[model samples]
Target: MASASTDVDFNKIVKQDQTLCAICHFSWVQKDARCLPCKDKVHIFCSDCLRQLAHNDESHAEGILFCPVCKMAHRWTEEGVASFPRLDLFNSNNDDDDDGNRLRMRSRTFVDAPPNHTRSYVEEIIVSVLRNLHNQEIQMIQKINETAANHMKKVREQRHKLLEEVLMFYDEKESELIDIIREFAAFEKFSKKVGETNKKVTKMKIRLNNKANSCFHRNIEFIKDSSLADFSIGLNKKEEEFKVSKELCRLPTGGRVCNTSFFNDTLYLLTEKFGGSLFFYKLLRYQMKTGIIESLHEWNNSIKIEYKLAVSVNIYLLTVGEIRVQRVTETEDDDGKFSCTFSTFYDIMRRKNDTTSFVHIIGYEKGIVLCCQDLDNIFTFKKIKDPVKQKWKISLNLPLLKIVDMRINSSQLFALFTENLHYIFDLNSGKILNKLKTSTGSPREVLGITKYRFCTKILFQSGCCLIGNDFVRLIDKTEDGVSSWSYKKIFDLYHTIEYGKCSEGIIAFLILDKWINTVYLKYIKC
Candidate 1:
C-alpha cells in the first residue's frame, strides 16, 4: 500500500478523528503511545488530547489497551510491543438455534506501532491540561487568603471592643470608690461634731449643778437667820435719846463731805477742803467695853478734793486726785489696833496736749475711779518686789457723766450717773460693754443706793421723800431732765434717827412726836 501520509489531508484527519491515534492515521505527528494502554486512544498529533486522555485513564498501568477500528487488545510499552492477558469472550453454544438473535462477532487485527514519533496534536493536548490545573490552583489559593484576612479583621474588632468594656468597668469602679471615700469623710465630720456637742453639754451640766448647790446653801442660811432679825414699825423716835454724837471729827473749815465708804467695819470719809486739800479720815467704831477712843490715825494732803470715791474694799482705799490717784493701805499687824497706813501713790494724769482725751473709770479691783463733773477714770496699783513698793499699774478711761454711784456684781460693775445713763463695765478691763437710759426718775442725788449680794435688786433715791402729807422734793443735777423742787405739804412734826443697815429689808427712819412715839419702818424690797 502507498504511504497514508500522501493520501490523508493531515488537518482534516486531526479534526475528524479526535479519539484516533494520529500515527495509525498517518499524520505527521509524534505520538505518546504510552498513554494508549487503557483504550483511550486519540490523535497522537494532538498533544492536548493525549494528556487529557492520560489523566482520565489512570488504570493504564494494568496494561489494557484497545484499538477502536480493529477491536484488538494491545500491550503498552515505550520500547517494544509486550504481551498482556486477554479478557475471555462468550461463545455461542449448540443449545441456541440460529434465529435472527445469533451472535454477530466482530474481528480486529493488531498492528506494530512506531517509536519516537512526535505529533502536533499531542503537544497541544498536554499544554492545555497543564494550563487548566494552574488556573484551578490559583483560584483556590485566592479564596483561602480572603477567608484568613476576614478572620483576622474580626479578631481585631473583638479585641477593641473588649478594651472598651474594660475601661468602662474601671471608670465605674473608680466612681464607686470615690463615693465611698466621701461618705466616710462625712461620717467622720459628723462624729466629731457630735463629740464636741456632747462635751459642751457636759460642761453646762456641771456649771448648773454648781450654781444649784450654791443657791441651796444660801437659802438654808437665810432661813436659819430669819428669826434673829429685828422688826420695827413706823418711823417715830425720840431724837434726843438716840442721837448721833457730834464729838466725831467735824469737817474742816470751808470743806464739805463729798463721799464716804464703809469697809472692814471702818468708815472712810472724804472731805473736800479749800486749796484742793483732801481730808481722809479712817474712822473706827469705838467698842463700848474697851474704853479706847476711836480716832483718826493719819491725815494727808490730796491732789484734789472734789473727786468721787469709786471703790473702797478692806484696807485698800482708792482715792482719785486731780489727774492722779492716791492709793492707801493699812499696815498688817497682829495687835488688832486699827490704824490706817499709806501704801503708795502714783500719778495717772494724761498729757493735755493729746487730742484723744478720755477720763472715765468704770470698774476696779484694787484701784481708784476719779469721778469728775462729766468724766471718770480708773487708776490701778501694782506691788513691786525687791525694793517692796507699790506703783500705779494701768489707767482706764471711759465715757461717764459724773459717776454718781457704782455697784459691783461678780466681774461686772454697774455704774449709774446723770443724763439717765447706766453703764455695765468689765471689772478687769474697765471697758464698758453695755449702756442703758432710764425712762423715769433721774439718778441725781442718790440718797441711799444699795445692792444685795444675793439678789438682783438695786435701790436708789427717787428724789421724792414723803413725811406724812409733806413731800420734800430735792433739787439735784440728775441724768433726767431738771424739775422744780418743793414740798407738797407739812404733816405732824417728828424726830428722826439716821442709823440703818442695808441688809435689813426695812430701814427705820425713826420719827417721834409728843402725841405718840411710833417708829415708821419703811420696808423696801429692793
Candidate 2:
C-alpha cells in the first residue's frame, strides 16, 4: 500500500492540493483563506494562524508568503494562473519519457507547497495594530521636531533684541557717568584754585599787620618836627618849643595865601592873587638870645604864578598848567636863597583830559628826577638835563588809566587812582609787577614812603577817607559833597614819613582849607 501511494501521480496531487497555509506549513482545511498562486489549501484555523505569523514578523512574513515549496516568491497574482506559461521539459520525438515526467512532477510540486511556521491569529492582529500606532507615532515626532525648531528660532530672536536693549542702556549710562566725572573734575580744579587764593590772602594779611605795628612806632618821632631843619636837628631837642601860627601873609602881587610848602629849610607860600607867585621865608637862629626874621631870595617870574610844590630831600618840584614841570634849588652861598634850575614846556594841551594833561612830580632819586606825566608816561631826568630835551629818553609808557597820584619805593613805582586803580612798576625794566583796583571809588592821594609796607590814605571827593596798610582798611566819608576837606585821618609816622625817629605821629588834612599838619606823640615799639 505504501508503494502504491508513492507511485501515485504526485504532480496531480500537488496541483490539486489546496489544503495548505501560504505563510505557515499548515493543512489547508485548518485555514479559512488559501494562497491562490501556490494552490495550497488550509483549514479556517490555518488562515488566522498564518496572518498572525505574518503580523508578528512582517519583514520575514513578506518573503514567506511569496513562495512555499521552492522558497521563491510568487511573481504573478492568482488571476494569471490560467494563462501562466510553463517551462518545456521534453521534445515530442525524444526518447526521454521518464526524465520528462520527473521534471514535470518536481515543477508542479514546487508550485503548490506552503512554507513552515504559523503564528497565532490574535497575536498577528495585535502586531498589525502596533504597526499602525508606530507609523502614527513617527508622524507625531516629525511635527514635534518642527515645533521645537520654530520655538528655538523665536527664542533666539527675543534674546537678540534683549541683548541689544541691554547694550544700549549701558551705553547711555556710560555717557552719563562720563559727564558726571567731568563735572566732578572741574569742581575739584576750582576748589584747588580757591584754596590757593585764600592762602595768599592770609599771608598778605599777616605781613600787613606787622607793617602797621612798625609804622605806629615810627609816627611818634615823625609828627614832632617834619620840617627839614627839625629833621636835621638831633633828637636831643625834645624840650625845644616851636611856634605855631595861623597868621595870613600877603604876596608881592597882593594876593592872599592859597597854599604853602617848606623846602630846603625855607617856607614857600603861594598866593591866589598872583596866579602862581611864590614867597620864600628863611628860618633864622635865635642864638638862645636874639630873635630875627630873615628874607630869602625869591623869583617872581616863576611860570604860571600859581602852582603846587612837592619837596624831597634836596629838591623842590613845581607843576604849572598841563604838562609843565619846574625845579627850584637852594643856592650854595645864600643860606636860604632859591633859584630855578630847569623847566619843561609841553606842546599838547587838552583840558579835563587827565590822561594827556596832568604832570605829577612823585619824588627824586640819585640826581635823577622821577615823575609821571599824564596817565601812561613816566619820565626820569638827569640833574643837568632839561626835561624837554630829555623827553625822548622817557623810561616808560605803561598802559593804564585814571591815575591820580604816584610814589616811588626802591626799584618799584606805586600808582594810585580812581576806579580803585593801583599799579606797581619795576624801575629797572619798567614793567608792571602788580596791579590792584578798588571797586568803591578813585584814590584822591597816595601818602607814604614805602610800597606794600606803608599806609595809603585815599581822600574821595565825596569826603570819604580810606585807610589801610598795603590794602584798604577803613572808609570814612562826609555827607556833604561840597567840602574839599571831605576826608580826614591820622597816619602813623613810620607809614607817612621815611625817617624812623618820629615820636607819636598823626597827619591831619583839611582838603577844603588846603591845610596839612602833623601831630607828634610818644613812640611804642610793639
**Could you give candidate 1's per-residue lDDT for residues 85-133 as a string of tens digits?**
1111212333544322222111121222356755477766765675466
Q: Compare the candidates by lDDT and give the number of the best one.
A: 2
The C-alpha lDDT values of all candidates are 0.35, 0.36
- Report residue 79 deviation for candidate 1 (angstroms): 99
The TM-scores, one per candidate, come to 0.30, 0.30
Tens-digit lDDT track of model 2 for 109-193: 2222234646578866765675466456556666776786777776577557555655665576566556655655665575576
Model 2 residue runs over 4 Å out of place are 1-271, 274-308, 313-324, 331-358, 368-402, 409-413, 416-419, 427-429, 442-517, 521-526
Name the lDDT of candidate 2: 0.36
Model 1 bad stretches (over 4 Å):
1-256, 272-293, 297-304, 310-321, 331-341, 345-352, 355-400, 409-412, 426-434, 438-526
